[model samples]
Target: MYAVYLFSITWAIVQSLPQGAPPSVCQTLMPFHGGGIRPQGGLSPYTIVPRRQGNHIVVTMTSALGIPFQGFLLQGRTPDRDIIGQFDSSSVNEGHPLDCGTPSDSITHNSPNDKNSIDVVWSPPRGYEGPVIFNATIAQEYETFWVGLESDPVHVTKRGANDPQFSFPLHNNGPTPPNYIPRQVKQNSAEFDPFYQGCSVTKLCFGSPANCVESKNCKAAVAVTVAGDKYDFELKAESSAVWVGVGLSEDDKMGDDSVVECVKRGNGIAAFMSYTNGNPNYGAPRLPNPQLGIQLLNSSIQDGAIYCRVRRDALTIVNGKAFDLIGKKYNLLIAAGSSLKQSSVGFHDLTYLASAQSQALADVSALAAKSKLLIRLHGCFMIAAWLGTASVGILLARYYRQTWMGRQILGKDVWFAWHRIFMLLTWALTIAAFVLIFVELKAWSGERNPHAILGTITTILCFIQPIGAYFRPHPGTAKRPIFNWLHWSIGNAAHILAIVTLFFAVKLTKAELPDFVDWILVAYVVLHVISHLILSLMNCIADRSSERRVTSFPMKDLGGPGRNSAYSDRSSDAPYSNFRRGLLAVYIVIILAIVIALIVITALAPIAESWTSFKSAVAPTNAN
Candidate 1:
């Protein structure tokens, strides 16, 4: 009988809990399956009291007339019933915090024990300055509950137009624009909120993950709102990043753009405007412009995230380019890095994104990263051009020159025919890869990395090789020797340069390849050198053996013309066919293996992530 009583209490406890979970819905705070029952309509024994604490509002849900309620669901909201701020998670235990859209958006009771009051630390929503109130639902028993209990109204601090700090002079300050006023002055840090509050609806907001802002879970985001001649930009980096910035560019590329950034130094956060001179290596990347038209509104550093609000001119000139935020459509560049030295920041190795299309600076949308198809194609084609086709072509022309003497391919010596085929394949792939990259960038890449310049030179050399081969003198001509020397020099130099360019490609920020890719390239180079050395040794041995055979076995017997011809051939030549073919097979296999490896790496440039996803797809089979 005691056990049955215990089971009944356990069942009641479960039945008395609110619906869904901790973050109770704004409309339905009552327990699920209680719709059939009517709530108490008389004066609720509960009342809510709200107290102000700086920028936050602390709400108290307690007995109005000394009546203790067993359970309650509490939330703060604006006038239109939209859930406003999140309750602090640490302040609630029995009634856990809920994640409606933002973290701790709602809090409700999970236990059934009676209590006089539940004090939930409710704070106002970030960036929201409208009036707010706390409404709570209290339940005395499983079947008895009260709804529509309300608290006194509270108003958040607003930035009025008459505020002197926000007023700006209409005329330009000569070459200098307005300076940034630090929010560190106001000493008002609570105004710092998620930058995505007014995203897309009232501002031009963009960031990574595309949906981060809409989902209320942005890692790095920017929202720009038009306010007369001035624009309000709220930026957020949901990480311990040293800096985060947004820039206006004519194209998707990073250089020649105008950047406004917030750097976190020591304990304070500040915003600044700078220009990147287009070439990463040619000039300083972060050239601070104290005269730029930028103003700091508010900023904060909490939980390692960097949030700042700033105002910028709608029309200004940066890097000699007329930056009319309201008139011109522009591609946006958002970047952040881990290190900062004064005004200069380290490479945007953490998060670098370019918008998919150009938009008027005042337009509203999330940041969609430009498609990387062209970039991927460019890398793959280059790998095939240099690593696979070019290497094989060079090998054939080097070692197989004398090996395929008897075999004819397309009316030419087999070695010469195959060599031409591979070389032309290399030429075609290289040219296509070159063209594709230009098409992707729409201009000559002004990146600071050497890969661009090195690849271009390699392409030029590869292009001249085929043209030079086509115009070569006949084999017996005096100039034939010169042609062969030039051809060898150019081909070898181009091949070496191409290999080195591939090495530099691994270091490119846009490449997104891991450092281990350098080791892969190193292995390819080592294997290629070893293969060449083996072939050279074999060629020398074959020559020595041929010489000894010819000297030892002399044609002493006089014979007729046909027989004499055959004997002469045997005496002059090395044994033609079998061993060289076997050697070629081994060489080709090794080359193909390396080529396939590089191609795989290029096609899946971000290889580790791809591998993880692949493993996840096949994990069930392995488990089984």
Candidate 2:
């Protein structure tokens, strides 16, 4: 049991490393003796030299073949650093040995003409910068280079106008002639090289060959310190599948010849393509693959092997008319250059079976999108409902101020009538919105995500605000000032809750609005607030104009039943009951409108999805 537990822990640690992650890296060594890599002059495969300096391990290249092998020392580094680094030959272009493309920079101890003159350097981790020294020696292919000390420390700080500088010399063995090197270093170049342009960033490096447009290669490595505290990253290749255009495949199809997908250690894209003349233009042929495209996650290919490099991030929509991941989704189609008619040896149709888990995930994503839209619609309706009620309440309050019937029911100078009506409407709308939120919560929680928690909080707050208001009343009335405070505070709180809930609704909908739409919403909200303020000011001015003087403290006028006639005398001789009744009718009509809107919204909601699906199904063909 202990052993099993130990093994499990060990495996977990290893698995966490970049090498254990997806897009595995493989290291293959090319021998100098009678191997495919033949340099200009015949040379015997000499002893392999090896050494480890700090965190970096180095190996010296030797040859026994008739000609010295001029090939690149391909190094593979896993993101996790499980397998810190490995040296190998080019997976593609096996016919010729890998060699340094013309070097743009001159490093000391490098032989200019030697094809195998290659060394890799990496920056140390962010905080624990340490000695940048690396040891190098020669050895046979069987005994691979191993890590000595996994980490070391270095000192780095910003110094104004003080450039950081360091230097090291490569050891020279028995050569009487000084190593032939270019007088000045040249910038490394490779066509279709992904890493060279942005060498220091997360992506891999690429360099182009001057003479060959068809040949492209990339290199990548990550910095690590001795402490191993830095986070390691997985080396990923772009999609492994390529989308070949119908025309290109027909024009370049060669019998038993296929393009091979190649992934450099740290590069994001998968393969190198010759653009000179083989394909009309180099790079991806722009074929469409939905859900899957040309990407090689740390993959390699041998010479004369043809294969599609499909990208995993490819999500096609509308039958290739639209790319879901507009920027990243891509594929490469490679046909044999030799023969245009025959299929290549590595021809693979770009199709993958969807696993049950993946299908479930897809379904969930689709449903989430739907839920977001529903919430948005509900929130909009709720806003309209609440505002409509507020409008009616305000109108009702004004009618009660001067009406004869209102005077009998609510005494003159009664400021609470309109506010009372407003409260009732506010409570009603809040309750309805809360119920809608519950429904949304239930729908979103079929699989239960964190967002449901936010929904629950929103619902609880919705209910609490109105309940607090139900027991609270304004000051200067029969009730104490505490009630007024509670009423105002809770009312404001409820308003804030409503706004928050609407925001959550938008989040749930995941409805991405264009920039213009966002700007329009902002403008509309600002305008609405201004209009409400203007209307409120007008209502307040009208209220002040209608304020009646309470000079006579007549007991009969204060009494409820007789107060009507008494107030009527003071009402400028105007009839108020008919006006009050008309206002009441308007409130009723407003309430009815809200009910009708709810029904219409519910009925129309389902149609939106149906229309969307129908359009999605038909639009792609039309677009094509």
lDDT winner among the candidates? 1
What's the true lDDT of residue 235 in model 2?
Answer: 21
Residue 451 displacement (Å), model 2: 9.3
Candidate 2 per-residue lDDT, tens place, 374-485, comes to 4445555555544455444444443344444334435534434555655566666656755665565443332113445554554455457556656654333445445544
Candidate 1 lDDT over residue span 1-624, tens digit each: 423533543454456564423433455554432212334444556667777554456677776466777777776767776666778867766577777667777777767777887777776654566676666767776546666566666666545432211111242212111111111234222222334444565467777534444545445677776655676677777575888888888888777777888888677677888876664352225554643798876566766888777778988787667888867888877777777765576667566678888987655555567887888888988888888888887887776655555678889867779889989999998999899898887766644588999999999999999899899876546676677678888999999999999999987766767789888889889888987887766666765766632221112111122322322442222454466678678767877887788778877756765665566568789999
Off by over 4 Å in 1: 1-242, 253-256, 276-329, 337-351, 360-366, 442-444, 548-577, 609-624
Candidate 1: lDDT over CA atoms? 0.67
Query: What's the lDDT for all of these models?
Result: 0.67, 0.31
Model 2 whole-model lDDT (C-alpha atoms): 0.31
Instruction: Count backbone clashes in candidate 2.
Output: 81
